[model samples]
Target chain A: MQTIDWIVLIGALLFIVIYGTWKTRNQNKSVKNYLKADDSNWFAIGLSVMATQASAITFLSTPGQAFHDGMSFVQFYFGQPIAIVIICLVFIPIYHRLNVYTAYEYLESRFDQKTRTLTACLFLIQRGLAAGITIFAPAIILSAVLGWPLVWLNIIIGVLVIIYTVSGGTKAVSVTQKQQMAVMMGGMAVAFTILIYALPKDINFSNAMSIAGAGGKLNVLDFSFDLENRYTFWSGIIGGTFLALSYFGTDQSQVQRYLSGKSLRESQLGLIMNGFLKVPMQFFILLVGVMVFVFYQFNASPLNFSPVATQAAYESEYADEYHKLEKELELNFEEKKLLAMEYGLASENERAGLKEQIVLADQKEGDLRNQGKEILKKANDKLEIKDRVEINDKDYVFIHFVLNHLPRGIIGLILAMALSAAMSSTASELNALSTTTTIDLYKRNVQDKSEDHYVKMSKWFTLLWGVMAILFASVADLFDNLIQLVNIIGSIFYGNVLGIFLLAFFVRFVRSNAVFIAALITQVVVIYGWWVDWMPYLWLNLFGAVLVIILASILQIFLSKDSN
Target chain B: MSPETNEKNGPKIELTWQKVFTWMLVANLIYVLIFYLIMKTFN
Candidate 1:
């Protein structure tokens, strides 16, 4: 990045932190104002909800996900609209009626304190770790591509979030997210524009999409019933719905966003807005990745995008093999580029013939890349650092494109976009984590505390969680895909949490003891299922939720019979 | 703040809950159709 780029990146981040803290100064006189924000309108609330979910992982990893995996990842959010509608109609009203500070507080009123505590602890554990990953996700990629130290990158993001979040509390998080979201969306729009404009002149939008489609990158929906297929339509709508329900409806970070609304209608409308905008936002980001994939068809792309991985291989005994693969990749690229150029001008039959060649060439390239990964793994072992570097290059695709292709000023803006996303999400997580800690645990257990005292405690907890997230990010390792890893972690716990809330809302007859016991059993089973790879992670949400409900009902009947 | 109204403190939309939900579902269906069309057209 140039000096101008650095200026833009640092300037944008500083503005968000300073603006947020300044705007929300003197606002946290009480616990409600500190943690609930207490005055957000529908629009602000809507953006805050959107920003919280679209973490740095969403920005940094998602396009890479789409570039490699195709647009099928979008199906993961297919259930969100339905989830939002349900939450608007069911969850919002209850949360508003009770005037609870945290989502878990309502659990105490409906079930026993144990059930509430159990659910809140589950959220804290998952979201707390997720907070670290959100920081680590962008930090790792930016560091890899920019040569920035990973630990410093993690600390920079964590501390940036902490400054504003700890200062202004929940209101600060909500307020600053509006600006961060603007930076994120605006930066992405600019990047997409540059990518499209930079595509070959003959390859208009339609032709570009055709090239992508021929390579099978445009497969947005899979209607297959296969559970093994990670993103089938059925899994998206069903499993995705359960995941969204738990996340938006039951998760404190999201619940707190809407709960800060000026009124129930405001919160409901804000969620409805998120529901409408989310899928398309994701679809557009994936489309950008598809465009990047198309750009690489005529241009050179690395056999492995990870610089660290590629370097390690070059420095090892497998260096000759790696050099041979590079030669093969160059030759392969020339042939594919020629065919792709011809494809833009081809007639129907010719297009079909060229499409086959293009697909075959793509497959050959993929095979070569996989071979490169195997060699890199072998080389890593020689270096005594086996498994330290991620073999998967999916997360590195977009940032590699940005650093190598984008203009200097724009590169900084994109970097700022990444930092903005990281800050927006990490702020919400720390804010919500602290809120749950303060309201559901500390304040609940230690009563008769002054309003100012609780507010102070909330800030301290926010700082503590902020530090914890930074420490976790420093030690974090690469998962299969950073975005999917975050979701998998959530799914492991969300199902049981959502099930508890579902039981509380609908199954009025089931007492607290029944749910408490069933939840424990269901949690163990869910973790075991995830451990054994019973199904895809998305389905874990359904499995855990259903298991909890069924077990709780049966246990309730058994308990009643024993009492009788 | 009964179930039907739930403390209606903002500007009222004329659409009922049933209608709003129908619209959201219909929008989803429309998006899915567009996705399928893209898949089919590209294939």
Candidate 2:
């Protein structure tokens, strides 16, 4: 990175940290003010909600996902708008009625303390782990790409979040997120514009779309009934809706974002803003990825995008095999470039013949890339990398492009955008984690504590969770696939909690014991199912949610019958 | 409910928010239509 890039990146980050701490340090004299921030406007809430959800992984891996897979991922968010509308109608008013600090507090109101505490503990476990991964995910990637030390990257990101979040609590989180959101979107927009300008002279935006579409990168929606297919319209609208409901409605991280609003109307409007904007925001990011895909078609791209993996492969026994594949890929790139030019310049009738050749070349290229990936995998096994990272080349695609192609200062802005995403999400996670710890667990148990005392405790809890997340991030590399493991852990617990909330909201007949017992059983069954490979992991969310509701109702009926 | 969440934000619902949602949903549907067209056009 150049001097200008450093200035842009550091300048953006420092502004967020300092501004957040400066603004909210004095406003948090009471528990409500510190944890609730009852004066936040809709715009702040909206931006904060969006920022919390868009972790660094979303910014980094998504474009890479599009580069390899196409635009089918956008379908995953199709249910979100509908999800937002539903939350506004059902979840918002109820949360307001209870006037609770944590989402778990609502569970305590409708059910019993056991159920509430159980659910809060589940959140602490899942989100506590996720907060760590949120920092670790980006730090690892940035460290790999920039050749910076991984531990320092983790500490820097974690500490930046801890400063504001610990200083100002929930209000601090909301305050900084607005600036973070601005930096993220502004940086992305600038990157997208510059990317378009960098494409070949022959390719306008129209022709680029044609190229991308023909490459199977623009298959936006599939209305298929195939259960095996991941990103179909049905799965997104059905599965995505439920997921969003659990996330935006019940998860305190999101609920807290909107709950800080000045009024019920402000909160509802903020979530509605997210609903309207979230899908398009994802579409834009994926489009940026698709554009990167288009750029690679005209330029030379490496067989494997991960520099570490490629370097490892070169040093290992597979070095000869890797180089041979690269030679073949280079030759194929030359051939495909010529074919693309012909297809672009050809008359209508001549285009069909050129397209067939282009398709054949594209297939050969894919085959060769697969061969490269296989070699990288084989090389990984033999390498002495104690913290052996998997060689998923797709994850490195866009960052690789930015480092190689984007102008120096713009590069800094984009990195700033990514780390800003990291800090934004970590801040929210830390804030919410601390709030749940304080209000749901600590305050509920402790009687007659002063408001000032709890406020002080909230700050301490924020600092505690922040330190834990950083510690987890530091040792995260010691275990392989901790990221995927964390995601799976989240899925296991999320469904049961969502189920508990659903029963609370909808099923009046089910009381505390039924829910408490049913929740314990459902968790055991869900984890056992995952262990036994009973179904796909994604289904666990629906399965666990549905199971708890069914079991709780059945248990409730049985209890009432016995009483009679 | 606290006065913070009472009649102030009740009854007199913002017509603009309702309209805004409908408009946003309409725009979303339009986005789907445009995306489908692009797929077909370039396919």
Per candidate, native contacts kept equal: 0.53, 0.38
Per-residue lDDT for A1-564 in model 1, tens only?
899999999999999899998999987788887888667778888899999999877887788888888999999899999888888888889999999988899999999899999999999999998889889888988898889999999999999899989999988999899999999999899989999898888888888888888888999988899977888889889878877888899989899999999877788888988988898899998988898998898789998999988987888889899999999999999999999888876776789889989999999998999899999878766653425677788878888999999998999899999999988889989999999999889998999979999989998999999999999888775444455677788888988999999998889899999999999999999989988999978778888999999999999999999999
Residue ranges of candidate 1 with Cα displaced over 4 Å: A383-387, A477-489, A527-539, B1-11
| Clash pairs detected, candidate 1 | none
Q: After superposition, how far is residue A138 of candidate 2 from its true place, in Å?
A: 0.7
- Looking at model 1, residue A230 earns an lDDT score of 82
lDDT of each: 0.88, 0.88
Give the alpha carbon lDDT tens digit for every residue of A1-564 in model 2.
899999989998998899999998797778888999878777788999999999988889999999988989999998888878778877788888889888899988898899999999999999999999999998988898899999999999999999989888889999899899998899879879988999878878877777777677899989999988899999998999999999998899999999998878888878888888888899999999999988888899998888887887788888899999999999999988877766666666786777778778888988998998888788777656673556787778989999999997888898999999999999989989999999988999996979989988988999999999999999989887898899889889999999998898889899999999999999999999999999878789999999999999999999999999
Off by over 4 Å in 2: A346-349, A383-387, B1-25
Error of 2 at A144 (Å): 0.6
**What are the RMSDs of all candidates, in order?**
2.4, 2.3
Which residue pairs in candidate 2 collide? none
